[model samples]
Target: MSRLLRILFLTLLLTFTACSKDDDSEDGGTPIAGNRLSTGDSARDFLSDENFDELVIEVVYVEGYRPTDAALNNLVQFIEERCHKSAGVELNVRSFPSPNIAEFNIQQVDSIEKVMRSQYNLGDKMALYVSFLDGKFEDDSDDSVVLGAAYRNTSFVIFEETLHRFSDGINEPDRFLLESTVFRHEFAHLLGLVNLGTEMQTDHLDTENGSHCNVESCLMNYRVESGINIPGMTSEENIPELDSQCLADLRANGGK
Candidate 1:
């Protein structure tokens, strides 16, 4: 129940917030590949090319901290397989040189976003940041700890020292799988899964959580009580893919 609650709180915090900076003047000029962000915008309107043939993803990690080869491979394979197999869209995943990792309070997400935009000169590509912090995230405004978050065209997955320790009973393989799952989950938000991007064709939208789907088995499900089980990691078979309704929304938005 504790893990579930933590997941729910982080999920909701992202769903209700926007990543826009205070000064648009310093915005890296070009917008992210997807659509423009606006107040109250339910879906991102992507600026996909006419053919939708390519999409770029920038992966960045804190200096001196890196995921194992297996973990990194797992993430790359998952994104490529899912995007190609489901939507027929090709992905160009670029890894950036590690930047200085910041121990950020939850309230500093906006500031972090700005720093990232400036460091990478982010424009027309999705950015994924992985941070290795020894402490849990706290909000000066509130007591809820944030584990991970995604907004606009950027997403971050932080691995806290306390959460990933071997004593926690999550081994390396398991931890990597959990990390991969969280990556996909947050990236799905950028893709506008469920009711976040496009209106659903079916009644599968979880209205209570407006940003996620009602289907419990889907990757876009509002809450993940425990981490998702993926093939080659948790299960012998069964690769994780977006549920039908969510796929339909991606298809409609030039994803394929």
Candidate 2:
């Protein structure tokens, strides 16, 4: 190649490499595409401080469907206990007018996230988005109802309207207990529980249910996130916790 052409090519290559590094560093070495990845894809980022030294939970809810303070507190406590964010964890809560939808599918929930979510991985902080909606999940049936779902690496939705319907009724669980249980259960999915991003230390995945623990008493159990099971699962004063097998998996995957 000519000398002039070769020099130009080298300069262009250097510029491109510098820009790429800047982009990667801005996102804590995660690509922009990583933000849209599937659930549990960022489990290590959430559990360990290798990439992110701080965590921010951005919670948005419909005006009339805000989660109880107790539930939100429980969620913060749950994360602090497991994840190793040395710079500390923070919660930012806000509310929006109801979207006026009675039922929501995963796609609709994702669309709402795209419009309403304001936080993303930046610098040394990893951000998570949680939404409380005034609707039931589209897949809910007469026999079973979903209380919450972790649908993306950093996004989840809680059917707060549905939770209220099921809780504090005849033979039902307390609203705070039920809300806290669903919140922790969905967050656990983001942390890669029950064979979901973090590898399991032992075989505990429920074969019939998708990405849930087989242990009935564990917070990752399938029934823990179901409205139909809340009465029975919340019969005790305390909420369910991660079983030994699930705890082992978390510890093995950079959790405390």
Among all windows of 10 consecutive residues in model 1, the one with the lowest summed lDDT is 38-47
Highest lDDT against the true fold, candidate: 2
Steric clash count of candidate 1: 3
Report the C-alpha displacement of residue 44, candidate 1, in angstroms.
Answer: 6.6
Model 2 TM-score relative to the real fold: 0.84
| Model 1, span 108-210: residue lDDT tens | 5444445554322133333343444444555412323444555444445454433353212432236655555566666667556666655667778778876
Q: List candidate 2 stretches off by more than 4 Å.
A: 1-32, 225-237
List, residue by residue over 66-119, the lDDT tens digit for candidate 2: 898988998899999999999999999999998889988777887788678877
* TM-score of every candidate relative to the true structure: 0.64, 0.84
> What's the true lDDT of residue 236 in model 1?
16
Residue 16 miss distance in model 1 (angstroms): 12
Q: Candidate 1: lDDT over CA atoms?
A: 0.47
